[model samples]
Target: MRRRRSSGTRREGRGAPASRRQGRRRGGTDRALCGAGTRGDTPWPVDYRRSATAFLLAAALAGGAARGEGVRDPVADAVSTVSPERLAAHVARLAGFGTRHALSAGSGEGRGIDAAEAWVAARFAEIPGVEVERRRVRAFRLSGGARRVAAGWPVSSPAARFLFGLAGMGFGYREPAMSNVIARLPGREPERLILLSAHLDSRPGKRFDWRTDAPGANDDGSGVAGLLEAARALAPLPRRASVWFVAFNGEELGLLGSRQLAREIERAGLRVEAMLNLDTIGGTTTARDLPADPALPPPGTLLRVFSEGRPQHRWLDPSPRRRLAAGPSEADSPSRQLARYVRAAARRYVPDLQVELIARADRIRRGGDHFPFLRRGVAAVRFTEQREDYAHEHQDPHVENGRRYGDLPEFVDPEYMAKVTRIAVATAALLARAPRAPEEVRIDTSHLGETTTVRWRPSADPEIASYRLLARRTASPDWEIERDAGTAGEVTVALPRDDWWFAVQAVAKDGTPSLPSLAWPSDR
Candidate 1:
């Protein structure tokens, strides 16, 4: 999620220098993370539910999980919070690393990218029950050009197909070399996994230039800081799904690290429930060119969700006003669902800043490591700021129009970074400490034109406090709170209509819920 030079005071200097820092769960998450009755309208794309095609009809028609009545709003408790100041300090430290470009010695011990990788590995080791590994891959070199195509996603139906072709520019360098910084927090159910990630690589070329520091302060520095902040905040809790915190490498060269890891996971039969990718997330005050949806708080908020797949709700002002859309290809990915839950949680806890769920990634033609997960059929989504600052990205250090510009730390707002860290912290703590997601969610369509009855089994976490049923119109972006019945084993309800799709989540008393369970139907 790097930006190119635009006159916009954008997240300008990336692939530059700087420091980095900072900072979630379910019913256990529902109780601890979100307040009751505060769920808002989701900005759904035109065909968001298509991804659930077979899964949808089955869940809705079945006498279980997907077909439920009365939206349940589970109660949540405050898990933990990380200080913005502490998170900001981490971002600053990352800036000091000079260039963390892909193929620049990020692993195998010391100096350059390798030194930074060591630091990341060391930090991960500090977390209890954590295991670390190094993943390798072949990648290409960075684009040797200015910041024009710095920041940028998809299709299916007529709408989806068109956008998909447009965003599918096949960027990323050809096979060169890359590595991924991987870690694991193994939980009881290995089948359900939630991942937290950030790229350890930057854009600018291998050679480091002093003038154009490319400190990457705001670019990925904010992302790394946020991940660290999250780890710090959630370290004390027990989790339902095994959590993975990865500082991905080779993203600057086109998702090399993620691609490498996804294939390995798939090969190893590692079942990943969902993935949350942290890209650029430092800009707040800087105005961004987002979809302009009213449901979203301002861009300055600690969060912004990039939902691909489905048309991500209606677009902002104007006729032919931007109508959001995404394809099951890579755009409407598993991460989209994950992002929605995160937004729902933010609405209840961190109400101070805004967190918009922008329909697409970058402006129109870019993507991040999350795409790899999507390709592998593993749920995944990307997180980043809503603005673009080109002057500082992938460019030589110089000045124009009497404005001294470079990817320097001065351009980034540290306070803004702190907020981003807090959000990451909250999400990780909740996810890590909460119970595993429910399985076999089914909708009760058998009682033709009758009440909705949904049901499912509890996760391995055993201490699940309640189960949540989320029902939304096929076109809505956000999920409405359906039913939050405590886990007394009564998993059935009545829905208003069969037109909408339903999903289930298991929450612990703290607020973290299992990876969401789409209402899966049984055979006729």
Candidate 2:
């Protein structure tokens, strides 16, 4: 869905040179490019010839299409290793657990959530360079009112009964302990993290039926399997930033595990560069009864990425007044930028799969593990199948009226799941290997002019060889143009600031581009 455009009152700066204004306001460190002159209060012309050369050089170094015929991309090689058979096997084993409900009983030997957690942990442990951590999270407790409602589920109306049953699948009165299984592949720079996550819990269509077989092979079994497969494929690669494969619990219980984990990361001051949450990413078709839309891609080839465009928490901007004065940035949230990055990476690496960027947080009121991370101001996005088959999700295995129902392994398309896993692998590997994104990115808004100027602090990574400026029209979904900023921290372009959106990315010496940071308006 498209968001309505918003307009803000324009502000004009006092009569002063752009460079002097920029330098005086933000200290002399701010760089301003003009038509001619030096580093002081003079206008410096943009070296178009040099910028074009750098762009092509960066692309070649990144192993992009510009590279020579024989160049080998370790990232592409890693993605090529995604095995459909391995993905299928992982899904089958997770589905074999019957039900991985957070409050389910069997904690002793080989059943319920505990067994599922142990199995996932063991798989990650088997990876040579990966270290597994079983993090204990707080228990999820159902509210008294929800408990009462679940207990009094009506038996009269079949439709009402089915709806209530589906709602109660993840609800329970007992306070069962939960844990998140984290697998870490430490990078050369361990402080920065790129996370790939999926929930490990499942549920049936019946209310509070933890004992019944929920075999969520497609609901989240597909996602968890994708995470495992990606981790296994990436284990042998050397990275510049850490990559984490997390299997969260209590997701069906209102995102309990992710919420706790997000809080823990915040308390510990962890810097998560980006989070790619894979959830329900295996479906290949819509329900039989639903009318088909010609616009959608034929089943298994399409994937939808949902990201929040507007900040959902107060911490992002404590002052409502300040936010209002800044005009509408509904389309520039960090998560949205990350979503665009995912689409670009997928387009470059997994050409067969179509990545559709959904300009919303999730499907209506429903959410996934990414929500908690987004609320905490982390860049996060969710991967879901293009069309969900309701008949196969949250339903138990049954043959009724000649129709089979259940989230069974047979319903999941392994080839499709592998494509999604490959996308995750490529995006994560590229982000981890690239230099950190430029910081304190800002666009000049002190004066109204036909041309726009952008500035950013240089990346601390000594390997950063150059920077790239990306821009697109306000109505566009993806970046349409790029310019090499060379080694400078600022650049001015002829495009009007009001009509264009801008972002900056740091390029490593190897030509890998970091996740782009959206530039916010700054009076200075």
Candidate 3:
């Protein structure tokens, strides 16, 4: 299902002469590259070379190449640690709760929402380097004419308290507040954050049926399991940016937990480098659980990553909305770039699991935890199963016309779930360790010609040792060509400015590449 594309515009500066280096160019090497002038000369954007350790590792892997950009493979090592048995165990335990509805007993004791929350929190706590905590948040009752908003109080707010006091007297009531479980692994850089999130609450039937059995083994129990697996696999991994594994509550109630979390991150002024959401990633087939598409590989081979090319803030903020009227970057927003990064990382680390970029916020009107962060201008994306089995989602445990009809452990494929979890781990680890993408990147189109010169300001991160230039035809799904433009902020590609899209990425000293920043022409 595809949606219409919306576009917006932003401005950037033109290039000025500065330091340059002789590096690989697209099509072929050009010693007189347009960007390169002299070596060791400092440009406004500080340039550095690959670290000794990175050079050693790249040489060890690439037969003495000074900087083999493709030599970063710690992600593959981390991906291998995701255990299918452990992942299955998480789903099995979550299903044991019978139901995890937001309104279910949250006393933090046994077999319900509280129990499920405690189970997830306990799993994160067991990881050696993780700091686990639970955050209290309000859950609303939207039945009747109740207003949809986050009350946030354990009991209701003062106004909500009064409303609850008058509940039987004739006003709509709200559910008791619930808590979201958070596990953090602080990194060397505390200000930078990469989050892996999933919701724990479940709903039976079309509406909230607290007493009924809604195992949610596939709906999001699979997602929560994936989060736990990733946390366990990544807990000991060294990250430059902090990594958070969050299990949210009240998702079925309208993404309440995530909404509050995003607000808090914004209020705290933390820079979220990227957020990866695992929502529904267990189903291996379509709505009826039949065979998957024959053209595609077997189960666990394909996953859907949904993202928006346009920043949600553009629609919310008046200034950008009024001034930028170009075209919606339907396939090139920060979140979309993060989506592309996930695909690239998965291809390199978890090669067996293919990522299918959905190129939309979510499926139709459906949404996930990523939306809240996206609204705050954070790059975020959602991971879901290639095809969802409707019979195993939001349905009560029962047999209708001789077919099973509830989200159950029987429907989830443990190995498939583990592969999905590994994808999240790989992407998160790569993003957390890499430097930030270049800023204010622009393409020069002062004259229409066969070649295009792209320029950008270097990342604030001093660890960035070099930059990579990427180009693809206007209609291509992936970047088809890559050039190692060593420490140069600008590069001239042989491709015509009008024939292809171009972008630049920063390469950290460790050889990890940041998500590429699309190079848009200034006049556009």
TM-score top scorer: 3
Error of 3 at 217 (Å): 1.0
Q: TM-score each candidate.
A: 0.67, 0.81, 0.82
lDDT of 3 at 344: 71
Instruction: Give the lDDT of residue 254 in candidate 1.
Output: 55
Residue 524 miss distance in model 1 (angstroms): 3.3
Error of model 1, residue 359, in angstroms: 2.8
TM-score of 3: 0.82
- Output the better candidate (1/2) by lDDT: 2
TM-score pick, better of 1 and 3: 3
lDDT of 3 by residue, 404-514 (tens): 788888888887888888889878887887777788787765556666777787655778877777655677676655567666566765667776777887777666777
> Where in model 1 is the C-alpha error above 4 Å?
1-81, 106-111, 126-130, 138-178, 205-213, 284-299, 310-333, 361-363, 455-461, 473-476, 484-494, 509-511, 520-523
Against the unseen true structure, what C-alpha lDDT does each candidate score? Answer: 0.54, 0.74, 0.71
Q: Candidate 2 residues 266-293, lDDT tens each?
A: 7887788899999998864443345678
Better of 2 and 3 by TM-score: 3
Q: Per-residue lDDT for 1-524 in model 1, tens only?
A: 32211110001111101121000001122221122233222223333223222222222223223335332222222223556676567766776766666544533333356667767778777766678776655433322331122211101145543343344354322233345777877776666677888888665523332122446666677777777666655655555567788888767655657767877788887777667787877773434543577765565654567755443224312122112112212222345666766665554445565677765643465677776665444555677765656665564456889855445566666666665555555565556555666765554334354444454554555566567666666566655444565563233433444556667777655444555666644323
lDDT assessment of candidate 2: 0.74
Q: Model 3: C-alpha RMSD to truth?
A: 7.0
